[model samples]
Target: MPTPTRITPDSLRAAARTVLERDGRDGLTMQAVATALGVRAPSLYKHVRDRDDLVRVVVDDVSRELGDRLDVALADAGADAATAVRALAEVARRFAHEHPQGYALVFGPLPGSASPDRAALDHGAAALLEAARRLVGEEHALKAARTLTAWMHGFTSMELVGAFRLGGEVDAAWSYGLERIVAGLAADGRGRAG
Candidate 1:
């Protein structure tokens, strides 16, 4: 009998990501990854424990990629805190649009309490919070970060699933919303500091 093709955890995660991008959240399975890798389903177990494990790994990888993007977006904003916050939101929106399936996997359903991959998700959240803190003092950082994330996630989720039936430009709506958020934060920041 021929030896099974050797596969690393990275290779498995890559194949899983491809499956996610092509077939979406529902289509990610060991069999699918195996098929993508031209191997048997059982062969995947050598790298990942099971479907959930594969998902955890894929989500971590995706989150890490997102963190990298957020880092760049934050860095490019220079000394403007509000712009940095907006830039992070824009990056999240673009990431959702570009990787809808991957985005859904991470942001759609709530993970279990004991999930082992919280760090990856936290890393992304921390990036946002750090940027937000720079804009609105540490006391209001969490709320600011949550508000930005909620807006980005809500808009992106709706836009991705065709929830917007209006004929107007959605991108325009997105920009408008970001503008409002920045304005609100600025007002709040000034109000609290005065």
Candidate 2:
């Protein structure tokens, strides 16, 4: 295999993403990525420092993708908090549907407190928090943000892995629940009980 002469950070990240989409987290490796890019393993070192580092980059890539989608959804949602909330949920579901492995990479636990690459984590959290602030008011945004994160994350995680396989009208249930949560926020600044 021949290594391409034009190597760049963005190109490396693109290769990493391709490996992720084709192979999931477990299948990703310095060797695998190099192989995908038609380069030697050592050459990958120039782009991705180590396995952990590469994972962080890949995870950040997916997180940023989700963030961008949610950002647009929230903005398009306008003043309709219910629409905003539902849009968030739909984006999560779509993420799981389109990128289940990537979703797992973000939501799944690491073996230890490897102290996630702080920059990536902050970027991901900031995106979520910003969307929350936009959808709801500042006063209730914090709590609503927590609710939105937990609910959407859990619900979509379950949906992707078939935890909701016994489904019959699950979408309806999700919609109803989202509306009630929005109403609660609008009414008394609280999340509806699951």
Candidate 3:
């Protein structure tokens, strides 16, 4: 048999991602990752705190990626805040579709009292704050950020679960609902858009 390659933090993260993609959150395990890497289980302890910590890292990593994409993908909508908002919604929705497991991991419950792994989660939240600041003005950025986060979460959750009825055009409904949000925001976004 060939010799086993060493697993570094980068390789470990890559392996963990593969596990998440293949197994979803439920199927990933410490031993499984070790086995996949051809290493003993204790060897993983050097790289990951524990299973919960590992999951947190995974969530944080994915959160950073999603947040970056959402910002970049929608920020180019120009002066039209409504246009930018719609693009933002689409980015969130598309993330759910394209990365259901990662999306779920990012939004799902933590294993226990463990907080986010610091880097990814904090940076992602900060990026979100920045996005809200861009969408609305500084005064209402916090409130608007909360509103947008909740709305995007609700819409993305509904779309991912196929919870909507089969009879209507979901895209049209989403657009209409989003328009109402933009209209409401415009009362405020209008001031900034000027």
Candidate 4:
């Protein structure tokens, strides 16, 4: 008789996420994930091709989750473009803070040629583009999205590393930066619309 399957891709990814969160990227090994799932390291190869493949799985999952949260935040942000932008940024920041390792994995450089799920990554990008479209019209939406993502990524990366050693209400600094970007985008939209 064939042996019963013990681990699914979902379970493997879940265990991998736990390992990543607890031990950071370097600690996320096949053995670690297998241990978390109560399986042997070799057993993980049945689900994932290798360690890089495993990381990609986790990355894809995190990307999808971030996209879902961004979508929900956008939905609840009302009709104001600025508010929508703020909501999206806040959601991203909170996600980063809550899942620093996962956030890094999603945003960090990938190993080898492995890529995260394109659809999953695009879900979040689409949400950002929608917000940007509202703020700056279709012509400039892509630029706005890129700009906002760059800012958010930089800020969160720094925050994650505790690089903001200047030490004066980091929350306020985040608000200040976000407001400036929103205002600038709104002004650009107005200027372009005129």
Candidate 5:
């Protein structure tokens, strides 16, 4: 007789994240997660509906974590809007680098039938929106947030896939891009104010 495993949803998520970080998206399987938790593959079905459900769970967890980190980074950023934006961007980049597979799972497109956890997604977006509001004010905050997210997604996605073949110092490039975006946002805010 085998010992009963005390697997909770939280533990499942942690195991899934571990598998994701270790094997990337293609390798994140129910069997892999169960093995990580020292349980039979069938045991996971008790907690999650299917592989899609598992992915969604991990996505929500990662999204909430990203939100928490962004909030912390912003809290330490003081009143300067550019500084806040820079802080937000840096945290996002760091998170992406740290958990590339999880980053893709959270930010990448999902299947038509699989919906993400709205509150978790909103939590992260709200942090960015608040930072954008500080930078560009109320009228343009959402757009600014979208622009920043898109830029980060594009750059990070490319970097993750080793797409920057002609790169001469990727770190410098990221800094240059962030600086230009910040300057542009500041100018836009000034224009709106004046």
Candidate 6:
């Protein structure tokens, strides 16, 4: 077969994402991406070193995508820092619900040693921290961001697996929980002020 010349890292990532969306993480193999690209599996090695490299690229791409979405949400939130922070959480939750496997990969274990993917993760994280810093002040920004990330990840992960079996509405619970956390942070700020 003639060598496929149009394949790029973004295209490979796109193929991986398609497989991830349709077949879960386990199905994102180099061969699968090659098949998706209508090329031989070895053809992928020119762009990616191996399976781990492919995953790293995909993770970086997806992390950047999530960061872009969060940035848009934050920008749309205007001057209300509290609302902006809450919007970050809500956007993260929506992203998780919309792409469970992709979310899992973003939050999942690394294939090997860290690479440029860490920067992508950091970029995604910094957006949340900056929003949190705006809301809770620099002194408490990291803690606040960590708290928000924990709640968002923990709650969304549970919700994804049908872990919330109670009769109460999950969305209501999520909103209430997020409100309490945001309120507590505000109260904490006030407490420190006085």
Report the C-alpha lDDT of model 6 over 26-119, residue by residue, as the tens digit: 8888988889888889998989888888778878887998999899988899887789988999999999988898898888877574244677
> Model 3 compared with the native: what TM-score?
0.85
Query: Could you give candidate 2's per-residue lDDT for residues 66-133 as a string of tens digits?
Result: 77787787778777666667777777788778888888888887644323566666666664566566
lDDT of all predictions: 0.86, 0.73, 0.76, 0.91, 0.92, 0.85
Count of backbone collisions within predicted model 3:
0
TM-score of each model, paired residue for residue: 0.93, 0.82, 0.85, 0.95, 0.96, 0.93
Ten-residue segment with the worst summed lDDT in candidate 4?
A: 1-10
Error of 3 at 143 (Å): 1.2
Pairs in clash, predicted candidate 2: none
Across 1-194, the per-residue lDDT of candidate 3 in tens digits comes to 88876888778877887888888787778987887788988989988888987787677778888878866865576656567767777787787788888887777777664467667766666645655666677777778868877887787788888898777988888788878776787578667668
The parts of candidate 2 lying over 4 Å away from their true place are: 1-5, 111-119, 134-136, 190-194
Candidate that would win on TM-score: 5
Select the stronger candidate by TM-score from 2 and 5: 5
Q: Which stretches of candidate 5 lie over 4 Å from their true place?
A: none
| Candidate 4 wrongly placed segments (more than 4 Å) | 1-5
lDDT of 1 by residue, 133-173 (tens): 88788899999988988888999999999999978999999
Model 3 spans > 4 angstroms off: 191-194
The 10-residue segment of model 2 with minimum total lDDT is: 185-194
Measured on C-alpha atoms, candidate 2 has an lDDT of 0.73
Off by over 4 Å in 6: 1-5, 114-116
- CA displacement after TM-score superposition, residue 163 of candidate 2 (Å): 1.4
